[model samples]
Target: MSDLNRWMQKHNLCPENILYLYRSDRKTVLHRMDGGEAALYAPMHGVLSVLPEDQFLNISKGIAVNRSQIVNIGNDGVYTMSDGRTFQGRKRGLSSHRRLRMEIGLSDTKPRPMSMSLLEKCSLLDDMPLAFCVIELVFNEDGHGVDFIFRYCNAEMANIEGVPVEEMLDRSFYKVFPNGDKKWLVSYADVALNGTKHTLHDYSPEVDKYLTIHCYQPEPGYCACVLQANEP
Candidate 1:
């Protein structure tokens, strides 16, 4: 059960080690739980777009907090973290967070109990019968495709590839499938960069399976695949 803390620590404070994100001078400062801070060139919205919403609460137009760790919101507009840290919050944000928590099925009357985050349930797609994966394309300085990162894969995908899910996520795709029969860069690149949908009917020598593979862009710079095995 990997929680947000471990995930953010490994991800280098890109997400949860950050208890508070403050926007200053058009730059976002990530105030980490370990008492360190880092500056991000981008705005808070850009960073939050890729993160899970379960823990984030916008304390202001330019400030967000990890509300899951917050234990109390005082009438004086101060929020108390479970670790006894306190931050001055805005009234606009306090009301907004209460409504959001209730809408999202979290209790608004008390502190949040410790629980597994599960990457905000993004991988819940694991229940699908066919193999599914999300690959993020990597490019060189010249904007040419060099490789791709395996951002996620369902259990069915792990089974089809004969690799563990943990072994694939955030890893190089070619490293996992060293014996790839055909070069996939062209197809995947076009899909990730141009939002094109492509399908291929081919066999994977690595897994010894013939399949109809459908590739599409779920978001910019990312390709999602649904592999239906013909040999099944």
Candidate 2:
């Protein structure tokens, strides 16, 4: 294993999540979130003075980038990807070009992994149905309580809960519903972590609203999509 991989494992950073790699002869492992795929490229020994290339794809600068990051290529320069990822490539130096040419069989860098930022992760479930959105709240192994905190809320949930999206990041359901049944929340977390699917229907006096809360534990701390049905 590479030194980088060893270090990342120690920190619980999954190597399978790598997004990109940079190298003069080989690729450097940068972001790794797209199931061990390399999606970006960079020049070795040319970081200081390498000219961008016409064919090189451009995404945003210093963030999630891929060859597809470029939307348009012209005198106006490279444009951001449709999804807002940024990257850029301009004319390459003669030597860099030669090196790139020589390594036609070899990858310029390793697979670049896409790092799923908080916003990007949340965006994963965007536009999902209100019932489907409630599946985000999952229970733990023993069906004791909620394992993962509800980080993102769909439009329907936001309206039903009467809580703004910005207000839900990292905030647990118990905190949101302080006066609600603590035992139920704890039980929900337990079953979620343990890999079970469940749901609860009730009215939230705090929000002065009625909601149908459903949760499915797809994976530990990961598979907790929730759906909220608001009463008219």
Best by lDDT: 1
- Tens digit of per-residue lDDT, candidate 2, span 1-232: 6554455566444423333333423443344332343321343323212213432322223332333222222222222232222233344433442343234322222221222464476566677655233223433222222323554566656766677776765566666767655445433543433465656677656676666666665443334556565665
Lowest-lDDT window of 10 residues in candidate 1? 106-115
Roughly what TM-score does model 2 have, to 2 decimal places?
A: 0.37
Candidate 1: segments with Cα more than 4 A from true spot? 1-121, 140-145
Model 2 ranges off by over 4 Å: 1-124, 131-148, 230-232
Strongest candidate by TM-score: 1
For model 1, residues 26-70, the per-residue Cα lDDT tens digits are 888777765677775776886676567877877767878886555
Candidate 2, position 87, lDDT: 33
Per-model lDDT: 0.67, 0.42
Q: Which residue pairs does candidate 1 place in steric collision? A: none
